[model samples]
Target: MTSPSDGTLVAEPRTDAWEFGDFAYGLEPLTMPPVGDATVSSALVPSALPPCNPDLVLFRLRLLAEGGTPDLPDTFTDPTDDQLFWFRWITGHQISFLIWHLMGEILERNTDREIPDRASLARLETYAYGYCAMLLYTGSCPIDLYQSLIRPRMYLQHRSFSGTWASDFVPVRGLFRGRGVARGDAPEAAGLARAVDVHKTIHDGIAARLVPEGRSLLQQTMKETVVRPSERTAILYDNFFMTLRAPVDGEGITSQLLRRLDAVASDVAARGLYPLGYGGDERPKELRSAEVAHCENRIGHLLHEVGEAAATPAKPLS
Candidate 1:
């Protein structure tokens, strides 16, 4: 491993983990395991990543965390309201990307089509709720900015761009969308079902609020029909979020998750998503409702199990 002369951490693309297939399992992270059998001394862990490194701006938080620094950006220490609004959009999407990716790994059918264990199902339920929380911050992006910058770009990229197009999302869509329930009437499955209900409502609410015009995305674009490129949409979605279909390891993502959760939890606790009169003045009227507020509270502050795990540094022991 080549070290940076100034000690800045350099991120590279990983081969073992893909954008959709690799999920970081712990809201409360488990112990970090070695990458392989041989383990000998170095605070810096080695990951055998290839040349086309996927760790872009979107993955900086996770990379920073893995390097043992505070998992958040330095400016986050005392952010202004304007800073909060802009950064929240970036961080919120990043968080949602991770949560969705993790959810995909949990719900994807195994080679033998085995059902996920009760714990994974339970985690699915929990993260379903967490994904909703992520919306509060993301949706908090000023309406003008969303319209002028985000939404227009989305349409320009692909009129039919949707979550259904996401590579990882395809595998887990059925479970969350009510088509596949692994355990018929079991409590674990039931919990996930219930969370799915809440998830849909929150998701739709944010989308509706953001796009009051109510225009539907195109069913299929001309290019899509002509090419029928299976992974095109998936690649587009991944690129939009600055994620890559690369290799990753369990211990790597898990430890990074704990650090990320801690960082998000700190931000949420220090000041609610919108800091009233401080940095943030107010939320849009549509998003200021009780329902939206509830989701905001749930994201970082109210997630008991997930929040607790973030309090400690979850680094791999040498």
Candidate 2:
């Protein structure tokens, strides 16, 4: 593994990494809808959206399924140091992906139920808006294990553990009973299963009260009942509803937001993290680091951009 400045590590990309190339390509020219002064009497009622807006949820799931195997630039690895930078980078990316997935569950529920009340929308918006901020933060800082570990501690000390979004999803170990993909599982099937488990556990817990319908939309998505995975991706692309709201008095908004974002970011990073030079590529150390960082940056930027865009209502594509 190559260590870089600020204790960051970079990993080499593999051939399979290109699986995400098309999705990545689709994400180019990403832009957020302007959060203008147009205030709806109620936060409900579907704000005007753009045609074919990017879906953070589906994009995130696809990213997670793909993992971080892409060929990264070489500048991120520093051999002279014993730091675990690459591990941290991957950990952060994974967390970002998970966070986006959870948020998707929230949006799906809100839209399907036609949550028409402004207060409800406000709560959802609170989460949605913070998600955007998180994306920006991740894109710019790119959390590592070090940051991940530290942030959680800090958040727990000051914030209320209840009412957080991820509090809904169950942990991966608890959800998946058998290891290795089933006979019919696809190449990415195992990873997708793990992702679904995570999504189901978390969303089921977090929005339990709000979505009183029982069984999260995430579960439905998995069953291919309400929406197919690919169709969910399109829905994610079309729906941009900010769930993060401004902190109210006595509300630990900052701490809550940070904790939730950090959790997902950390999880995703862990999933994608790989050791540098593990593949036996003869590429120069510095070049390899740069390549990894490039991929990390791409993932990070997409997370941030998607969050920003999701803050606004997505219009139907003509």
Candidate 3:
């Protein structure tokens, strides 16, 4: 008769091996019959089992991604303190500036007049700034529940934003029409897009390999706690692109501009995850770091491209 332990699936196994789905019946351990014909009793036991609650990992990620406050920390009473200042800065000022800049750039190119009305520019800037601030405040949170919560939601959000940005850029080619500026002229956009493509490449490449490696590290460092370094990096990368593509105008802002601003705010949100003082203040030494310097150069190049694109003339939409 089948009993618990030998081949039985009862009494609950370790958390890692527990399968949330079907529970196998307990079977007695016994020697198999000859190879001529193996009976049901002779079936081989599974060498390994899937995790019990995969959702738990995703849920933890969400908590960490959305855990902090913009104006005040839930646990801290000080309102003016910057202890969580990075969080607030990302959600508030940075994003707004990004959106306003993008809007101004787009509007300046599309509008016929050489000089746009000051009032309109002011209004656009205000709206873009306000929305960025709001987004920063709302999106900035702690990393307490990242493994189970934040990662899954962020994955979905990242996909949605990526799709939206691609779709939006299709029609805007008209804004860059004329002025002999070939699509190739915006090499920086192409480069940024390439960087994003590489980021995704690394993400997919390391999904199984790096994710578990990172999780193992976290488990070692903080028992019972699973950290999602890959997911965090992905979200931050998304923010960086959004900011990098922020719209700009010589005049006022527009809705298109706000969208770009949101990108910067998102970048700030992503960067906030890193410890504030982790990078030392040695400019030359710091610049030598490939990853850090690459990002700085990329941002600078992208900004220059956008600025140049804005300065080019556009045929009015008939």
- What's every prediction's RMSD, in angstroms? 10.9, 18.9, 21.9
| Candidate 3 lDDT tens digits, 1-318 | 234667654433433221211221111111111111112221343222222232332232233235321221233232222334433433333333433344434455547743334433333323322332333232233333233444444455542222222222223233223221112244423432333333333333323322344442224435544334343433343353322222222232222232232233233333442333222343223223454334333432332233333323333443
lDDT of each: 0.51, 0.32, 0.32
Instruction: Point out where model 3 deviates above 4 Å.
Output: 1-149, 152-255, 258-293, 296-304, 307-318
1-318 per-residue lDDT for model 1 (tens digits):
345897655644333322211222112212122212212223444433323322331243333323323333332336445555555665566566556656665554332444456666666677777767776666766566667777666678777756555455555667667666633466557877766766666677667666767654544355455323255665665556544443445445544544445445545555555554311324335455565556665554334344322222233211
Model 2 misplaced regions, further than 4 Å: 1-74, 78-152, 159-318
Against the true structure, candidate 3 has what lDDT?
0.32
lDDT of 3 at 306: 32
Give one clash count per candidate, in the order shown: 9, 67, 43
Query: Residue 312 lDDT in model 2?
Result: 45
